[model samples]
Target: MNKVELVYRELLFQALEKNNFLLTQKELSNLLSMSLSTVNLSLKPLRRMNAIKVNPMNLKTINPRKVLLYWASVRNLNKDIAYQTRVDVSISEIEKNIPANCIFGAYSAYKFRFKEVPADYSEVYVYADSLDEIKKRFPSKSGQPNLFVILKDVNMGRYGKITSLAQTFVDIWNLGEWYSSDFIKALEMRINGILE
Candidate 1:
């Protein structure tokens, strides 16, 4: 990289040395005290060199080790970006293994068909068809995005874990006479997993 390119790379790397892996282009520009265009121009070469992969969204990530190296080379700043990267990877794995489509709602169903699941069962459940669907549907999870995938099709969003309380009730009511009474009762129990 050229002198200007290296300098800008250092600036970008320095800002990401901390635990905050989600750095925006605007934030990087602000921290580097350089124009956004300058920052973007400077970053272009490093990215071309395979040092960084830009995801121009609310949450952007890069290779922490390379970033820290650039930081040290330019500003003599040493930081362990590996730890943050590890955490991000680990969190991603955990979010990938949840189930899809179950436990939507049960308000009227609760009072009429299955009055077993207490009001505490008020949370609405969100599920998906697959993991790729999640990344495709919601690229970056921003503030209160209200959507999370325990793994692919399995999700916890809107209300997190459960969707709106209202939806949960509606689903239960709709399935009232469809499934067996014992089955619905079993669902009220945390252990009853039909998907399993």
Candidate 2:
């Protein structure tokens, strides 16, 4: 109804689709570049309207809340048919197998991993929210996210992994004149040093 509400909805939907499952208020705060208080305050109305769902209904210092919010656009669709469902499982399962998270510190890192979506993140390209949850889902995860690896053995291959040539294409596509960004160069230097 209000402009601010619309923005919150957009951000929440992005998180739902991006994170594969649950995103904490802290992550949302960082990603949106908004204060935690502001994020929490704004979420009140969204929660009241049933636009979002908070799991556990408990709070803590490090991992206070888990938002299981859904986007309005696909509320009527079956859970299996929704795009966000796949991501929820894919990310968790992947992390479970890896038993750790990837360092998605920048756009290049994310592009090198996940294909480019029309989302914009300022820092830390990709990370997992829950290792245990997704790992549990991995075995039966046959949703839209398409984890890509170990598809036959587990719940994967939502969008699927890009081939090496395809990776080159997506990498180049996401990184146009990355040389111009001092940040990109710094990151490349760091990663390259590790390789060498």
Candidate 3:
């Protein structure tokens, strides 16, 4: 993921998870290790969409859904795929076999985050810093991919276990599966509940 997406992730995480919608550019820069200009650039769309109020001292998120959809629109989840393999095992077994260091994404992310599956899903996606363990476990197969390992960003560690709400939303938005829409609808309801 790019630095701009990282800013959206942090901002959404704060607003949705932490219940803190206001932050200064310097604080965001420090949290994501980005420059002030980069953080400023990331906020431009939010500002234009009237999703945030950017005062001199701080920025307040007024519409997190707008921010989320903006990120989802710009997110390139496919480009972040670091490794892909056909894990023929059941989805549960495949999830269990994932490396401990990985952060679950896509279908598995919705299950982990919400403790329920919106619909039956066939694939598992994860973000991992290294693929050695996954490679050893899943190996290679000849069929279509059921497991995808996304390249983990340096700042991803801030969200433990599963990917953050924004990350999960954007990732699911990029998927083509029919059940992916189910997950997206469930997530939107959940996010609306949180941000309400």
- Give stretches of model 2 more than 4 Å off: 1-21, 56-196
Question: How far in Å is the alpha carbon of 45 misplaced in model 1?
Answer: 2.5
Candidate with the larger TM-score of 1 and 3:
3
The TM-score, computed over Cα atoms with residue i paired to residue i, of candidate 2 is: 0.25
TM-scores of the models, in the order given: 0.28, 0.25, 0.97
Residue-wise C-alpha lDDT for candidate 2, range 1-196, written one tens digit per residue: 2223333443433433333235577766665556778767766755765545666642222111122222222122122221122334333344334323322223434454545432443221222334344345444445434332211111112223321221122222343343325433443443344324
Against the true structure, candidate 1 reaches a TM-score of: 0.28
Judged by lDDT against the true structure, how good is candidate 3? 0.91
lDDT of 1 by residue, 43-95 (tens): 67557655566785733435544543443344311110111111133322323
Q: Compare the candidates by TM-score and give the number of the best one.
A: 3
lDDT of 2: 0.36
Clashing pairs in model 3, backbone N/Cα/C closer than 3 A = none
Task: Return whichever of 2 and 3 wins on lDDT.
Answer: 3
Global Cα lDDT for candidate 1:
0.38
lDDT of candidate 3 over 72-154, digit per residue (tens): 99998888898898977899999988889999988898898778988999999999989898899989787999999987889
The clash number for model 2 is 12
Q: Is candidate 1 or candidate 2 better by lDDT?
A: 1
